[model samples]
Target: MSPSHHGTEPVFDVTGVTKVYTSGEVEVRALAGIDLQLFAGEIAVLLGPSGSGKSTLLNIIGGLDRATSGSVLFNGRDLTDFSDRQLTRFRRDHIGFVFQFYNLIPSLTAWENVSLVTEVARDPMTPDEALAMVNLTDRMSHFPAQLSGGEQQRVAIARAIAKRPEVLLCDEPTGALDSKTGVIVLEALTRINTEFGTTTAIITHNAGIQQIAHRVFQFLDGRIASMHVNEARIAATEVEW
Candidate 1:
């Protein structure tokens, strides 16, 4: 069946996608026929061990990488058909990414770092609004170095969501922080997903983190080993790491 006929059409429709890389004489299959769908206004977590294709899938969905075979559709448009320039525009206009390292500029204040993307975005929220959403409004004037690790990550999240992108992709967003700090960051992420209604996907190795997701997919050997719906997702603050 075509993806459009699904009960709720997915924001991301990945079908039988595969990615292979060759290092000298050795070839690695990073993704082995991944078929998944991520719907709107939901938090989906991809859980897996290293090299299990979690990041690979995220990259493909974000249009940062291409698959060797099969197709990925975003809002029903085939991503495989987009040219490089088109892909760039698509990513810039429709997707937001948050990484584990909290890649904020040390020289810039929190507001400034968040505003950088707004300056170039076609339509964006004010830096104040974005910072407020992440609970960093009071620290808007603080530089990355001046903020705590969790705060820095919050600033990164602010920067990403400032553009009001349709999709938010997080790659182990709390990986660099301690468990307590990570929960704070996750709380901020959860707030964003709930308030903004952005379709969100997070990649993580932390099984405990999955409790905060509306749905979870476990990756094994570069394929989806299991998928389960979470009827009652605990708040990030309530979940133990």
Candidate 2:
């Protein structure tokens, strides 16, 4: 299938996208006229300090939020026009998300948590395959409280990928972990992107994580300050703290 049809074509096509929030009489411009394109089978890193609009852009693309103006197209579908119901369906069928906190259900075992997504997915991988991808096969029966921080994050990754979503969006995925543990989590993410050909986008303040990306975009004051293509990405394990 063409990338346009299956999100295999440039995974994202963002054009002149802008977001503005009005709180009483005050208006906050979270994104200012941004244009970008990202492709599948690659890892893209978004770098910026706090309040730089990195999170805003990620949210719009992931369908968690909407842009006030401009266009966001995934594959060829114009996301700007999608209704709330349509966005939910799109997110359910095509997107997976990871956040700084490992948002696992406290009552569920690792395997049970990972299996939740598959139950709602159109065509999903088995929980065992997803756990194995993150090297958490042995911890399937463990609960989140019983696992280490890194292990819990791996279970989160397993849950996200078990649905076999075409896109994986991560925001400050390692912010809550130590550098050493974070790298291990990143390795699992890298493995998922490489092995499944999932289009991956990561937002982080840590420049150290950029070494693993095929492309990097830097945001500043609600705009893209710079962008670069990395010919070679260093392994996550090789990144320096």
TM for every model, in the order presented, reads 0.96, 0.95
TM-score computed on alpha carbons, candidate 1: 0.96
Which candidate should be chosen as best, given TM-score against the real structure? 1
Clashes of each: 0, 2
Error of 1 at 110 (Å): 1.0
Q: Per-residue alpha-carbon lDDT of model 2 for 36-89, expressed as tens digits?
A: 888987789999999999989999999999999999999889999999999999
Tell me the tens digit of each residue's lDDT in model 1 across 134-216: 98889999998899999999999999999999999999998999999999999998898888888899999999999989889
Worst 10 residues of 1 by lDDT: 1-10
Report the lDDT of model 2 for residue 15. 94
Inter-residue clash pairs, candidate 1: none
Candidate closest to the true structure, highest lDDT:
1
Badly placed stretches (over 4 Å) of model 1 are: 1-6
Model 1 residue-pair collision total: 0
